[model samples]
Target: MKNSEPIIKVDHLFYRYEKENVLEDISIEVPKGAFLGIVGPNGSGKSTLLKHLLGLLKIQQGKIQLFGTEIRSFKDWDRIGFVSQKANSFNTGFPATVYEVVLSGLTRKIGLFRFGSREDRKKVDHILESVGMLDFKNRNIGELSGGQQQRVFIARALVSEPDLLILDEPTVGVDAQNVNQFYDMLENLNKELHITLVLVTHDIGVISDKVTHVACLNKNLHFHGSTFEFNALKERDLSSIYGHDVQVITHHH
Candidate 1:
């Protein structure tokens, strides 16, 4: 891919479930090294757009390109890591250690019938360390706090060393203190590892200061620009995006 190409590109996108339109003529671009945050009220097509970008949902209208290739033809699945909102609900009672959970990320590369090699184990350890969960490597996944479990899931996503990481409401069950720490960890990953991040969040205030770019969506994209521009927008403009009276409050750590 060229250095100037966007990591994700969407043009004139539209999606419908049954007969109801969830997304309408959406167009956006996420460039390399971008910490892009997609924020909107509930049922505003935030997750729907994310699903389209990840190729989890069929595109009925418009075009989407990932890493300079059309979404339909993009074959480099290993280059992208995804952590869904339902990650926290994964069989918490299952008999799996943190190490085992993260190691599973390589199942596609290591093969289902085979075991991870020494180098694979090293990679898992390194990823867990990066997420600050190495100390809990041997603990049961079900025993950790919500934030710790989320970090483990992130480690699992990173074990494959993806170039792009997409997270959907990853901070759902995390407490206030851990939520801040979680975003800090993501920022470190973006800056130090150079992994492009696409985060879907409903709490715009928490992520506004952490992201490099912001896109507000409600059936259509209301705003797409630098974080500075997004922050400078008046409440009236933001209210329009929510389709109701609203206020945006940004928090900085």
Candidate 2:
């Protein structure tokens, strides 16, 4: 990717679900390797914007570019890692082992017809270790706490070693202690691995501390810029996006 251009760019994008218009002319330029937090109230189309980035929902108007080329036309999706709220919500009684869950990410590299080769297993092992889950590799999914389960999901997401990672509500089920740990892990990934991260979250407390950029959306995007912009905005602006009175307690980064 060129240094001058955004890694992910959305231009005047519009979308409608059934009869209601969901997103209206949203545009953003996310520079390479930025930790971007997308925040808004419920039903504000935050997740819809993420879907547009992932190419799951097609844009009815304007354009979306991943590394300058249109996202809809890009074929090498393996370079992007996504861990939705569904991955952690899998049936615990199904008896999928931890290693198996993490190794599932290798499916793309192993191809459809062939089973996982020795190299794929080796890669899974490395990823499991990187995510600090090597010791629990054989444990059943049902046995793990929410934090452990989230780490396993992250390992699965990292098994592909994607250049960009998009996490939708990664800390929802996790406890406060592990939420901090997860945020620490993300910071390490962003600083050490230099992976671009786009996070969808409502936990403004944690995000304000770690994320450098922010985007506010309400069925339609309202703001996209540095976190400092959020700091400068009046309390009324925060209330406007939240659709109610919001208490924005800030801190030093």
Candidate 3:
């Protein structure tokens, strides 16, 4: 792919669930190394759009391209890492060490039945350290707090060395106090590791200072621009898109 090409491109996308339209004429481009946040009210089809990007949902109308290749023809699935809200649903009683959990991310590349190589183990350690979970390497996955577990999950995603990382409501179960740190970690991953990031979140205010761009979606894409442009939007404009009174809170670092 060329350096100027967007990592993800969606064009004239539309989706319907039986009778109602879930998404309408959605189009957006996520550039390489960009930290893009997708924000919308509940039932705004944010998750549906993510599913389309991940290839979990087949495209019914629009077209999606990943790594400059059309989604249907794209074969580099390993280049994209995904962390979902369901990461919090892990059984607390499940027995697995943090090290093992992170190491498992290499399963796709390592193939089944074969053990991780020493280099693979080192990669896991590096990823865990990057996510601030290396100290918990030997600890049980079920024993960590919500925020800590999320970090471990992120480590697992990073262990595969994906060029792009997508997170869907990753802070759902994390405490308020740790949310900032969690976002900071994500920002570091985007800036330092140079990994492109696409995050679906309800916390627009919290992520405003961190993300490079924002896409406001409510069935149709209401807005898509730099963080500065998103922040400049009037409350009434947001309210109109939300179909209810809305308030935008911006956090400044």
Question: Model 3: how large is the Cα RMSD against the reference?
Answer: 1.3
Local error of candidate 2 at residue 90 (angstroms): 2.1
Pitting candidate 1 against candidate 3, the one with the higher TM-score is: 3
lDDT of 3 by residue, 1-253 (tens): 8999999999999999999999999999999999999989999999999999999999999899999899999999999999998556878887999998888899888986566999998898899989998899999999998999999989888899999999999998998888889999999999999999999999978656889999999999999999888888888998898898877676555
The residue ranges of model 2 lying beyond 4 angstroms of the native Cα positions read 112-118, 249-253
| 1-253 per-residue lDDT for model 2 (tens digits) | 6788888899998888888988898998888889999989989898889888988887888899988888878987888899887535767686788888887888777765454878888888887887778999989977887778888888898888898899999877787667777787787778877888999988776567788788888977788888777668887888888989887754333
Question: In candidate 1, what are the lDDT values of residues 126-237, reduced to their tens digit?
Answer: 9999999999999999889888998999999999999999999999888887888899999899999999999999887865678999989999989999999988888898
TM-score of 1: 0.96
lDDT of 1 at 62: 99
Name the better of 1 and 3 by lDDT: 3
The TM-score values for the models, in the order shown, are: 0.96, 0.91, 0.96
Once superposed on the true structure, which residue ranges of model 3 sit more than 4 Å away at CA?
A: none
Error of 2 at 93 (Å): 1.4
lDDT of each: 0.90, 0.83, 0.91
lDDT of 1 at 17: 91
Q: At residue 185, give the lDDT of candidate 3.
A: 92
Best model per lDDT: 3
**Candidate 1 Cα misplacement greater than 4 A, ranges:** none
